[model samples]
Target chain A: MVFEEINKKDWEAIATYLSGEMNQQEAVDFEKRVAASKENEAYFKQVKTDWEIMENLKQKNTFDTNKAWGNLYNKMEQDGLLDTKSSINKFKLSRLAEIAAIFVVGILLTTLLYYIVSDTTKKNWQVADTYESPEIRTIKLSDGSVVYLNAESKLYFPEAFEGDVRIVEFEGDGFFEISKNPNKPFIIKAKNAEIRVLGTSFNVNTKAGNDRVEVLVETGKVQLTATKNKSIHKVLEPGFIGTLDNNNIKKEINTDINYMAWKTRTFNFEGVPLKKAVEALNRAYNVNIVCNDDRINNIKLVSPFQNKPLDTVIQVLCELEHLKFEKQGNNIVLMPK
Target chain B: MNLILRRIQKGDLKAFESLFKELYSPLCLYANKYLQDKDKAEETVQDIFYGIWKNREKLDIRVSFKSYLYKAVQNNCLQQIQHHLVEDKYKQYVKSEVAHFHSDPAKEMELQEMNEVIEQTLDSLPERCKEIFSMSRFEGLKYREIAEKLEISTKTVEANMGKALQAFRQNLKQYVGVNS
Candidate 1:
């Protein structure tokens, strides 16, 4: 029978039969029908082709939720929108508890002295520890806290964390892994804001001349308060972030985790504006990324890179985005299609 | 489709989660066809979902939900490639490790050619037939699975699959004739 002559019921029957849902008699009858006419055979093949195409298309449409969620959590943390204090606190207390309880007092005293001397002896303290430019230096604190100082950034902490509270002052961008000590909360002083954490992984960016201070949390929690006003405190959990300007504080949650990928020598951008991505590339590689075309700068991109060779990255971009680039020494210029 | 649209638009996290789960692998495979990088494809799909969530309030749907999603994925993949071009020029040999993760060029080219043919054939099928065919072949769903997913009887699935296969056979008659 011609395709048009086949009723909907017959179509349904054919579908079932092909699916092997029919009885032996039904299969035999269907086979006979197919053998009876070339038209029937042609129709059957058409349906099969259609099914294959649709199936392929369907497979192409599903998204990986786990990775998506992880990225979201990371983004939120990078943005400083989540409350991470509890986790940080838990991490800190556990570390503190691990140390020999007998020497807790001595360690505490030394930690106190370290913070005091680091803060007071700033100019006199020979750059005993120098982190060269264009490198991230991760320093382990006495309380087991870790600080990831961004390139061209400097941080002053004591030989050991000490006192009722541990405090450190930072310049540029750095991600902190504070060891929780509820009795002595860890505080970071950057520009005009004070970031408090028991123990958490978060980034604080305060580059020179940039009027805003940005904080992002990867795991655990933190509390950020404007140093000028204590009541202006905002709590953050994992996947949460906060940005502080001179007069405003903005909080957002569930950002992509790849935001903090710089610490891992990888940069991930998910639907990031072209301008922002360029800025990140400039910062990470310490080079200039210029978009000559205004339209090109406004386009958004979603991709990840892990220590990718500059040439390969460019090739991928050209092939995938249909865009061109010009390399002028340390400067890379981006142009539109 | 309307229900999914409504749920997605309302910031229903569960709906969003389920939607991602349902579409992730397929979307990645689709992206891989064009980009040739599984990781990039996965990232592109994630970005599309994130974009949908971020701009859900302002979204205006004029086509099937799946169509919109596919288009978005395509756009993101293209944009990612473009951005990489600019950034790659400045940085030195940083991501050599990742470059090695992609399939060899020969395999990629073959897959690309096959994809183009499949796409053309898919476009030529009747609307319902095309949908059912894709649900089977691309999705790797059995006939019963397709019937259950589409809420149709198993017999209908068998009929549609047969019709789809016949269509593909005719459209690709030249290639099939030479090969067979």
Candidate 2:
């Protein structure tokens, strides 16, 4: 078929070929026709390019659903639209406070509860260590299990394992790379759920105000059970995510694979908006990076920075977007060029 | 929709949060195409969500929640464009709002420039063509899937996608010529 004189069927054929919706015969024919001419090859490349660009834009423009919920929650709170009888309270925490007073209170409550649980349950050797940060903290327990705590996160473990089952409590988010010990099963206690593991590496994230603990397993097998109902449990293997809340326990093959960005610091942003990126970067770096203008968030960054300093990352991002930045007090203020 | 909508109607805030998380990103992106303002787009979607939460008990949706959301965003975006007076002020919406990049800086810049052209070309297509094309391209729907969701035939989806591509090619003729 002539390229310029292509009809509707020809267009369908091309679409199918590009979208991988073609049958074998159609694919062979189309491939042969396109490969026969330089012009055809170029046209095909253009179409492919357009498709790829759209896909990239879709990926990059994906806003944080969690953040979006937080934003909507704020709006609802402002109007008093949230259900008064519901337990899902809105925290309105912006990750940056002069002293993080609410966070401190939360930590205190969590620690107090840890002691109470240890005493009531008749567990031995309870030790709670809270890590607040200018840097991510790596904690090594007596049993050789290592936990990397994100900023403002905490981990409470026993000084020594006194029984066959070892239990630890985690608040906020932490990555655990457990040392393999078959006899001693490891348990993670969070607000709404408990994760039991034989020997595994996983990340547990429990956000404030939301009574849910999200666990993503990196390696090995683990069982996640709701705090209220032990019978409702999910056995999660590697690449699986288990989310336990007051209502239910769910397990799915993880698709949001970049949840480890906080722990790993390996970013893959193709065209993410600046504001969203800053929100995440601020959490990871434990600094205040504010984009005063909403328009600046539209500026996309494709930084795949691995283990880079916050300053260097900010500088590169600013230079790429032609944005100006300077230190203001303890925060970095990004301005339009 | 079945589980969450029921709970939301009964004033379950957590259930409402689940629904919001599922649809927020796509809806915001859809609204942004028309308003060309991220804040406005976000505000528009947020307003709709807030409305849903507030009136959950009396919820009346004829279509699936997914369809209802896309339609709502489309309607809001068109309304914003029609009533929005300061077009020139927001003229830099697409270019200034999004930073486009790939690994190679040169190719990334080219792709970034092409994004504006592609957006313009999309705007020039017929309304239905634009919708079908976007559902396939942005929402990552298969042709048959778009057809089923939009209550159209697969043939129609293919044809509209064709028209969209043909239009894009004609509009970007100059740019393609220089680059390719």
Candidate 3:
């Protein structure tokens, strides 16, 4: 059995229907054709899906709606919406309520600033703050523990430790030197992984837009667990690291010893290759340094730079290695003298 | 008459947010079709919404809310392209556009794994035919508008569009169950 292929008239009908150009009569005629045969209906649906697939293809995975909302909120704050105390108190702002509130950012910031100012006296108010890095922030928890948030990190905690467990929500990276509490455990909740400790010092690093969260215990014990499956957890002792990379948890010896460089503003590279040293400097200063020469990587460096500026570190490194360095648009290139 | 638009006109932030949630993705997708850069597309859409919010009280809605937003995005994207062209960054624009179009490995694999169905079918289309079809579909240009822009007749535009659609349907016969 042979069936006739859909002709130009049917194609025009599809285009008209799709583009919403069909008048009432034309729409009725097209509907009759579609209703008369399953083939016509199926063809129309296929064309529609094809159009949709193209539209979907146009959507790159980079536009995060939540982050876009955050940016918009920041702009609103700049626009003087949250300036007055009346506006703050009138809305009775909370994060969940702000979602449905007419005044969006003012409500969120009112709740945030209110908690920031009165968090010490008010035991019930929880405070949330987001900090972008290269701007490391020192956060003092009510329990006397201190957290140093790395650049591009968010930390949300209560004004006071209310419950049995002192919990804080995190995204991105931070270093925690938690105060000892025998009865209550300090927990950092990230997107996929949770780190729990009674009292300890450790570094947690998770890159934004990447699905890898790493926790390295510098002192005391740290328990790293999947947020979804608590049973799948790992306990790390000092000098050990646990990583939830691509949904697989692995415990390994902490090799990247300069994880605290972001917080400490210090770097220690002993007998390491120039590549390793350059990588550390790049991370510490958020600068781009490339030494791709065949002979560059083999050069060893044993240097300790403490609390020095980025240019000084580069200058000292260049002097010690007998290399001349040039800067190009936030990037430094080192070549043998 | 969108309830969200009405509420937004009355200076309601929640309704504005609701409107953002509804139209944001479509706007970004539409902008990306022109800009071919995700960050720029997002920024473009964000700026448009920000303007809408800042001037919500006096927003003159001459058309449906959806069409208004779409038109605004189209105008902004065209202005951005013109800006790029003026700065002699049109080469970079084309490169980035090609890179973005080819960047989706998952979509490529899915199109192949679903069957050699949709991916390679368009490779056979003439360059002019493909451009005209895409300008119509992606740019939301009318047949006459496309004809004017391309310096061709409306009849030629329709003929090309019809050929492109027929080619797609013909190649996609097995996938679409055209005969079955």
Candidate 4:
């Protein structure tokens, strides 16, 4: 064993190896050689001990005695160590509880700051994007309520809804999502009729002609009144279709769930007959669809379509019935192949 | 020191702090010798001193107060080292199970000599060599960081570190033994 013969290179190698500058494979290989000889291991251990004792330089020279005492004193106070033994443990626990309470309040304030910094609502007084077109449009009112207008429709609304009731007038078809405010109600004046919204709800006035206006309630309650009669009114609940003409108000349980399919482009048909389905599809997509045979009327559909093109829904629908749809004149005809 | 200890036993916080001011750094360094972690070493020493003051009224000590602190800090560090051994660290010192309470008077004398040797060895190095050594060991600056900060090449820093460690090795050669 080479006990007293470590050269300069060996010392430098040990220094770099202990500094962790040497790669893992190099350190492992070096460790194997060092552990093989007792003298080599002792030298390695000596270097390791020297590395540890290096801190003595820091302690003896640079350690701030006053700062260290201040820290220990603070810790002792926190742990109730400075207290006379008679009441030490109790003070320590209360001090810890006080510190914990400060932390909890700090966390709550930080969460509130995050919310204030990243508030999701777009804050502006200027209204944007109002129009009538062949495509759909969405308008966000000042109250955070949204209005979706179908083609051939437009709204007359202010930059911000004013007064106790947020009243917006519109022509043709539009979907109103009135925001909830118990103190202020939302009223829609469309085609000589009014819808008083007491709560936040999704209700679509699918279409409003000179003589008729239709309302379908998706959620919450809406009272539809014919402005011409004043006494003719109906409270429509969810899944109820309320219609107001110049004479009377009519409401019924709406089985045609595809009323919003025009703006949403999503169709949910459950056990609906092909003929009746075609009728609703015509009103929704504004397309002409004809399934002429009475035998095809009993062919019930139980499929759903979301944002699908009219041709895709037709093709899938035909495949399920062993039939096909072809464009014939202005009508898309569904017939047996 | 014994007078201060007697005062501390009578609930004299000022006396306790006087002893703390005198020995805090050395005891922290002593604990670091076993743990190799600065914060844990400081924590062990503070806890030992805190335990003494908290239970001073019921204290029983046959050894000197400094001796008691060294013994307590060593035991705490050994307990921590053993605890980390359960986490599979420091497996190289598995035989450090051999160091649970090795607080003999000879060991204390050897450590006292080693501390003096470290001071002498560090003081004897070149000014730049000592800075590099302290940067690597105390400030935890990498050779690259030290090189950048000092505007020297990394090779110079490494060589200085090597020279400093070698100087201490030569000075403390009296402490290393030929046993397994």
Every candidate's lDDT: 0.67, 0.74, 0.72, 0.74
TM-score of each: 0.47, 0.42, 0.40, 0.38
- Stretches off by above 4 angstroms in model 3 are A1-135, B1-180
Best by DockQ: 4
List the lowest-lDDT window of 10 residues for candidate 3 chain A. A124-133
DockQ for every prediction shown: 0.15, 0.19, 0.13, 0.22
lDDT of 1 by residue, B1-180 (tens): 568878867656557667776666756776775576777787777777766776777899988676677777766765665566567642232245324433333333333344556678778888988888766655557777777888998667667766765555455544421210
* Best TM-score among the predictions, by candidate number: 1
* Residue A59 lDDT in candidate 2: 50
Chain B, candidate 1: TM-score: 0.47
State the fnat of model 1: 0.35
Candidate 1 residue lDDT tens string, A1-337: 5666766555666666655567898899978887688888876765554344344444443454555666764564465433324567877877788575757778679857765765675553222122456666778767788887777777777666545677778777788887767788888888888898887788888862467888888888888888776558787766667887885676665445456656776876556667777777666655677876777777777677788865676667655667888888878877755
Higher-lDDT candidate of 1 and 4: 4
Q: By DockQ thresholds, what CAPRI class is model 3? A: incorrect
Fnat values, candidates in order: 0.35, 0.43, 0.23, 0.53
Q: Model 4: per-residue lDDT, tens digit, B1-180?
A: 477678999988668877997778777767766877777777788778878878888898877777777778878877887787866547766457436534453465356567778877888999999998878888788889999999999989878888888898888887775121
User: Could you arrange the candidates by DockQ from highest to lowest?
Assistant: 4, 2, 1, 3
Please state the interface RMSD for every predicted structure, separated by commas: 8.8, 8.6, 11.0, 5.7
What value of lDDT does candidate 1 attain over all alpha carbons? Answer: 0.67
